[model samples]
Target: MERVNVVYVLLYDHSEERILMVKNKGMDSSYYTLPGGAVEIGETLEDAAIREVIEETGLSVELDGVLAVSEAFLEQRGHHAIFFTFRGKVVGGKINIMYPEEIEEVTWMNAEEALKYASLSTEGNELVNRNSTIPYVLRGKVIHKN
Candidate 1:
């Protein structure tokens, strides 16, 4: 199966009760996902996460460490994706849609309220509830590499 690596950043507000997320029109017309994107060639996962957040949400953040990892078999997209989720703090920048062309909207949501969105990314939902440890690794099914 063709493989791809991506990163997901859980950019929490200083109070630690809110999350930075984006409504990515390109990925799904109806979902809000964490601020992150693919790891480009030569860029570390940490750097990619920071870059993606700034590009997508216009916020500069400092990563704490890996929070969780996940794998998804996107049959429709024909790729097996490995997602590295990082926990980070917003250090700078104001709320703005940096990539308005791609991002439908960006917002700061109460951690609990964000979880209620039916279209929120599954991996994101899972991680929100599993904050007991750092770098929690999630093993996904090979199913179809779908």
Candidate 2:
């Protein structure tokens, strides 16, 4: 079985009512996505999210907490992505392109606007609504493996 592990951060600015997101370097070109990526061996999920955010957005984050855990298999891509999503607060570093290889631009958008651009595998409405973690899944078979 092919397995992919990634960490995504949801950076919230309560004062601004916005979230920081990245325009990702997609398979074709790039698409806007929550700042995140694959976790390497020996790295904790929080560390992965922090590293990925810095790599893709040039920012350091203070994790607020774990937000969600998601897993999905893409039939077309023939891969499974197990994701750890965390709630984060921007702590330091300027907002810029940290890695030109995988990121194009960064933007801050409110929940509504973000919904328009993000191809969210999981619904963020609850994030907007209850401000809590919820189990989320996308298309394909879901297996609870130990």
Evaluate all candidate structures by whole-model CA lDDT and list the values in order: 0.77, 0.76
Against the true structure, what is each candidate's TM-score? 0.78, 0.79
Model 1, position 25, has a per-residue lDDT of 80
After superposition, the stretches of candidate 1 with alpha carbons farther than 4 Å from their true spots are 116-146
lDDT of 1 by residue, 72-142 (tens): 89888888999887888888988888777788888889988766642336765775667633643334434
List model 2 lDDT by residue over 29-108, tens digit each. 77887898889987777778889999888888987666767788977677798877777788899888967777888988
**Candidate 1 weakest lDDT stretch, 10 residues:** 132-141
Candidate 2 residues lying further than 4 Å off, grouped into runs, are 14-16, 116-124, 133-146
Which residue pairs collide, candidate 1? 73-146, 74-146, 75-146
